[model samples]
Target: MRCFEHPSQKRLLRFISPIACLISFMVTDLVTAEEAWLTRSQQLLNTLQGQAKPAWLENNPHQLEARQQVLELFNTSKPLTDLKFGTEQSPMGKNGQPLKMLFISFSLGETTLKGIFEEASGRDDVLLVFRGPKPSQKLPALMGDLKRLLKGIDPVPNIVIDPTRFQRWSVASVPDIVVEQDRKSRLHVRGVSSLSWLDEQIKAGKQGDLGTLGDVGEIAEIDLLEEIKRRMAAIDWKQKQQQAIARFWAQQKFEDLPTAQADRDRSVDLTITAPRDLSAPNGQRIIRAGQTVNPLDKMPFGLCLMVFDATVPAQVELIQHHSCQDKKARVLYLASSMPRQDGWDSLKRLETTLQAPVYLLTPDVRIRFQLQHVPAIVEQVGKHLVVHERKVRASQGAPS
Candidate 1:
């Protein structure tokens, strides 16, 4: 708005001012749009992404997106295959023509989802996208499907995209198939369709070819304990011991079951130590000690005695027959690796008051002999030794 002395100056200012204002406005709008897109994409990304989970997810990752994906997978009406999907920004494979991947995105009630996954599991080439709210009980089911998908694509690349974290398509119907050729662009197809029918559409160019799709197949249940033992047979005793401990929780039935807050608060701080595998072969195959083997050659009895019971009675019987030289009633208990002397004193006081014979063993002796825990006290009770309790302190006993 400077007073132009010359006519040329005045003419130049009139043309330049409007152009500058227009450029500034456009720049501002462009920035706003980019910010909004970034925010949205980030939220979507959180839902679909999980880096390699540790051997456990005992503490639920509080990320909202992760929780939603888990819930969605749980409730789908068709068996949901978690597609190893990605956009150009994030893809399943590098360098090859991306697999023609199809994912269906829909929001159905819990009943609908449970029905869908049960139905859709057998289909080929169709994966389901699950989006829901909060903590989910469907993690095990989703993990089961993931395991199956992983098996078909063996030797998985180190950096494959986690389908659990991304939003690729938007569908307008219940039980729909969301298809994507490029991560950036997606389509929703309405209907209840079989896996074969869906695959046919992908071939027909009804869906874009994204180059990498997860296998739509049933996941096999892995006996992790057996797998670990097989892998450890050639390794050293130390490794075998370590592997046993490492794989113990995974072998347990209660590993990932959800708990109410009150239930979680009341959970015992009990530690499970890896016990020795001492099943000896009978004729063709090795038989577990103490009990007859099953038709599948599984050690049902040995597992009960060794794993569940911790060999207390068996050990006491062995001691009585070999070391005790008399029939006696005895109780045995083992303490934790890290001792709580206060617990020992309590137990000792109980023994004094109750008039019970008790004993203790150091961790070195326990490990050398491949025992579960320490401060083990065994009593002869009519030719049997039962592990009364583990990691119990003398102090933990009722005042005798």
Candidate 2:
């Protein structure tokens, strides 16, 4: 080297010194950082392991006894303490007078019951009474029989079942009638009688003796002309109702959309569609083509869309209880169709209790999720919607 070093060797020596230094420094830094991370991780793991576990309740004889006691209490019958009888205000008759009471029994022959109901039919003032035990299980069958007897009546008579009232008035026979003057004065018939014979008796009692009898009026006869007019009015009212429903369905934009399924994660971009305003600002929307979207951007908040049939109440209740776990997601309840008035009323009560928003299932929503059966849950994951057909087990307290 003293004789004269080569220029290439000198250049190589200068470059190699810095490169080696850089390599050594990088290796040392990596080793130090890795050691520090390992130490911190070990400390965290030890801390977690040292923490005390939560105390959990274990099954015991005392718990079992308490549960059995609770079940026994629930199984006991609760007597009606504040029961009142005959407090219902009678509806007004066509003559603007309060209707009279006609008490009868199911034990009466079918022909006799039909005859009495036919006479009492179409009279708003005539309240029909059927004597029976408190209707706990046999109410539906009794109502079915009554409806069959009053088949063609324009306005079916208001029938009440009151075993207590029957006992109070000393009604001991199958076919009986009770004529009342105001709420105080009452006349009780204890044997089978025709409507005409009852009318005659009521007239005789009104005229002959206010001492023995009271100011009871005769039962009004059914006016055929008035009945025809009422039938026409009912038809007109039904037509109006149907038209209103038609108008409601026509205004819905997504009524005819075909149902589709989204059982997996995927993007659903609209290639030739226009943007529209959504109900919620944070809600998912149809992504338009040519719109730039960041793949790494965080997804919008998910929704728990529960589709259910109003008919399956137990299953719906189970779903409602279970779906509360997803606290971050909003719940939207949708019924399969417009149910009967009673079912709709029940849904309204449930909506109030749950404090959740509910809607009717439109074709658009049903088709979008391709929902076959309900109750079902629809939720969003990444860019796609996941439709889950939740099966309710009989063991889960859902009705089989």
Candidate 3:
């Protein structure tokens, strides 16, 4: 009031006041465009609204894929699809794995394994390799086999359970010796467990398969490499694929909600304070930091989101009859829960039953809508979201 009493100061204040208001309004509009939850939700839904993932991704988890690819490494018939082989360098295998290895299996027995381990001791380049896990591909079996074989041997040999090496050298028998340099086999001796014999043969300028100098004993156990290949060939990947997909879906973190009980209605405020300056698509400054925004003023909602638990038949039927289904606005179906037994199958079935594409409800959409129950319709009414939680138990026999 005292400052307004001065005429010159009043004129200056009048000059700056309009500019400040203009800046504040611009900032508010910018934030509204940037931080509006509805705008973000619509964009997300539009991208994934009706899109179904490929069969491989839907049914395959990383853990199972990892195990399968490793198994594929042992199959010599294929070109080694897994990434266990080195592609370059003279002596260095890719990812710093050893190039020279003694291909021995648990069939070598305790005494022969002890001898090989002692011979390979203090040798960095010569790594003891197993064509496959002992007894079976299970980790516990492999660990038990190692414990049984290397009980008394001091300084456990540098060991690697890489079946790729056996495939790389086309090893048909255990206790095979191989030295690779520059992606080419330099020396390979089948039916020999002695790393010392390999070194002596190399010293004598022996290259290629040179183990036939004298009689070599036959492997006692079934060729584990061949057995691994046979087992791999016998796998029912198609059946396991469905199980893998189910596991993947079961591991997902969905914001599970209870069945809608009573008829109710609610509102969601679209107001958001800008975290920073936001720009429009045309590169114009819209909202600046700290400005409160409501995006409905500029961008109206033209899409209706119908959320329900797909596992509930009554709720699904209610959604089918919801008024929004006949609205001019684009309707998106989002399921809170679906059958985890065969997620892809259930998704397909839901889409078939509704004659429309269905998607899984995301946590962000749930939080933004402030959803507490399923079988709900979310749409914009005027400037804020209006969630219509309809009661269908009386006629529709919705789940309690």
Candidate 4:
């Protein structure tokens, strides 16, 4: 009883202390000379709170100044009279102010919606309008955007209403955005955007000089067919075998050893066999159909098989055999040691960086390669192997 009562008393005291402190601080603060200046500043902001004041001006001075610097060209726009935006009313634009409101919507399951919202939150002037079919489930996304925007800056005033408020705002897909000029407002994006892009839009609206934003390497989206091709291209067992055959043929004194086509003109072809038991003691693993003959007892090509605990030979060959069997040119396999989702992210980074074809491999799907690191690069150059290992400074040559 004592412990329970003590906890209840502590909870009550904790809840009351902050309110008491706040009241005491408010009383003291209201009496000081500095408080008088703060009061005057607040009053000034209130006076500037005309219907057409820039969105940044709705906040305090610090926020206003930060927005002005970030927004570049500040314009004045009227506050939205009708908070609701959807099919019912026409979209509103500023008759003369700084930032514009953009209403956005999405179909569903758009991962990039948050990134665009995050970009918008950095500016005080721009108002982001979001509406959804299901208001309860959808409103959280908008609230989250607003909350993030309000952080680290004076809270920019925004009105959130249901989907039935304004008209003329359009959404292309799940998480689409519509830009509005609410009298004093400017334009905001209705699609995927970045912070720099948002800044550029603000500058563009103000007729200020703005430049393009650069990209970092990462795969944005993966095409299934292209991924298959990439994995196939990584195989070198056939290519290497062909090279060895060509070199042997060139050295032969007799021209009777099937002198048919030139090595350079002929392409390397290969067939990969699944796990098969070998007649030898080494116990076969995943082996190519035309592998080198074992020097010891004469039977057939030394059969290799992929095993669990026993030593698995030719892990690289196994990967090439399985993953790239049907793939063609312009193919890629993005492997990461971090994790599967992280591997996909690395794939995205590569897509962004290379701006080319690439695919991400799922984690836990253990490939035979000794990839115990991050940022490892593997590529097959015809019959030769090329690997670029990312280091602290720069990547070194392909792992020997």
Candidate 5:
């Protein structure tokens, strides 16, 4: 029995109650700390995985930063600063994290495979491991097959295509099962078996072969790792990169903005009425429907938005005269429009000249600030947003 709950400690219970409360508080704080650390760790891991996934998939020229992140995510990586993955690197976690792994190879004709997939569906502790993709089928085909198998199944089976696990646990055949818990291998059934049966055997202190799968359909003829390497080697990365850049330009939405005929300044009332009642955590009505809320009343306007047409040379010169200097305020440059033929060069030049990043003005931002003319500066003053439209003449500033 626990010492605090023991008959011998009954008399001392009163004395230790306060101490127990303190210990409970400590445990609560520790759990909170652990959760915070876990969140941080997950964020870092996701960043590492995210960078690698996109750059690798998009066929970009090279992702040095993504490679570096991958290196940081792993322990015992060589040359600390090197971005490229080394050939002769010793990885950390060679034994693998303790897990219930179900080994399977992708095939067009594995009938029992569908059943196994369904049985393992939505299970957190169990994972379906594939040796590699099917020889005749591409990666997309494997995904499609899985899609068909787990159709309408919520929280589908977790899967991975890594031969390293097969090598580690000596998983020679498909549909085999292994149970690992508490950082140790408990049971490994190298043959056809169900997760439930394998679990039962492991619990009952039983060990032996559960028979093997018959000569079913075509097993994955290709090694997934080798196929991946081959595909990467065959790709025309230069053409892929050119296509990416072309797509970027095609997606640009640079709208036309009429030049300002006359200089004028206007204030836009940012007050908005709530559509419904907004309540506090205690169910108290903080704001009723149709009540106005001025954001400026609660928070200071801290950003100076500068909007101009990048296509117009004179307007560009007009923006240069104004450094957008505001005390303790951030400056944001939004381009009204850019020539599609030379948008990249124009954006780069604007950024270089202003020593700041320039963003394309979206319809939402234009509508949000109620912008009607080019070469305008939007600033927050008091409870209102002031849009200062600078009139550009045919010579002094920019032409219409």
Candidate 6:
């Protein structure tokens, strides 16, 4: 028996048939393309394996020569001078007192450095020594480590790197606190110790005797009668001098002063129109449209102000792009507000990279320009200033 198909079923079949055929054709084409690609890849790999390898790839003469030169340079380095004890005049006190020298090494840990710093705090009499060269590459790292260790109380110990001083003290190892009162007397304390302990050892040494005081009886007495006679002679001379001065003033005639001249051009005062206040409650300021500023008759050339939030990384990239675009313009980078240490660090890095000066947005500039959002560029156009605020996209690497 013959069956009639529904019109809806016919339409469904018509749609499904083409889609199924297209998918089947796509799968067959994909499988054929993949097989061809695999065959080509295998042939290329086999050809590469059969080829001879380069001799330089196994043994590079240029790389070996560079390594040999580096080794030779390192071997030729100068040897450090041997450490020994010597006497030097102390810079801390007067009367040629010998300084108590304490030699230290930078290799010491932060905890030991901190302990030594606490011991030497408020005591300028003792000398802290460093054996290494002054202002070395490693010195800044050492200083940073010390700063982190001694939080709040920034105690910069007096560090001496004089080879002569280090040798005179005979510093063998790190954390050696040596107290030298004189050439003959020296107390060496190895490792980290308290300042009070060093001070006690210094006090235990023999004290020098105080010298004889001057006698008051040796002073000569002043003569009162001779002093009175000298005063009377001076008073008589002053009266004669005053009488001669009065006669000299009476002989001279007084002349009238010359009248000052006034120019008509500068007589009229130049009036300056007050700027409109557009500061919002949320610390944002919006300048009104068609508002013209008439502070000066003519606007200065090539003055551009770039305002941005330094905390935003995307805004930083935008500022860098604009800086490169406007080479002739005097671009001043102003942040929305003053940033903390980390923000300031990022701002400083941006400044160094862009080679431009970055300043915090003051209240005066905020109100005057009426800046609302940042990543904004303000520049002088004809008689008025034009402000352009650019939209910043959220960066994937930026902190939430």
TM-score, model 1 to reference: 0.21
| Best candidate (score: lDDT) | 3
Judge candidate 5 at residue 397 and give its lDDT.
Answer: 41
Ranking by TM-score: 3, 5, 2, 6, 4, 1
**Candidate 4 lDDT over residue span 1-400, tens digit each:** 0012222123223423323233223222212322332233333334433333333223444444445532321111122223222112332344544444444444222445444444544344555544322323333354464455444432233434333223343232322333434432134233444546555555665432222223222222222223334544554433443343344324423101111121122121222232332232344332334443221121111111111100111222232233222233223333221122333333344435434323222222123223333333333334322333332222323233
lDDT leaderboard ranking = 3, 5, 2, 6, 4, 1
User: What are the Cα lDDT values of the candidates?
Assistant: 0.31, 0.46, 0.61, 0.32, 0.59, 0.45
**What ranges in model 5 sit over 4 Å off?**
1-220, 236-242, 276-289, 323-329, 397-400
Q: Which ten residues in a row have the lowest lDDT in candidate 5?
A: 76-85
Over the full model, what C-alpha lDDT does candidate 3 score relative to the true structure? 0.61
Task: Please name the candidate that would achieve the greatest TM-score relative to the true structure.
Answer: 3
Residue-by-residue lDDT tens digits, candidate 6, 136-237: 234335345545654544334444444445456554455555554546335565553456755665688723321222211110111222333444444433
lDDT of 5 by residue, 86-190 (tens): 122222223564467777765534567677767876565676777655667655566567667666655556665565566677666665676666545666666
User: What are the per-model C-alpha RMSD values against the true structure?
Assistant: 31.6, 28.2, 13.3, 33.1, 18.1, 37.0
Better of 4 and 6 by lDDT: 6
Give the poorly placed runs of model 4, Cα more than 4 Å off: 1-95, 105-113, 133-159, 162-166, 172-179, 182-190, 201-400
User: Model 5 TM-score?
Assistant: 0.49
RMSD value for candidate 1: 31.6
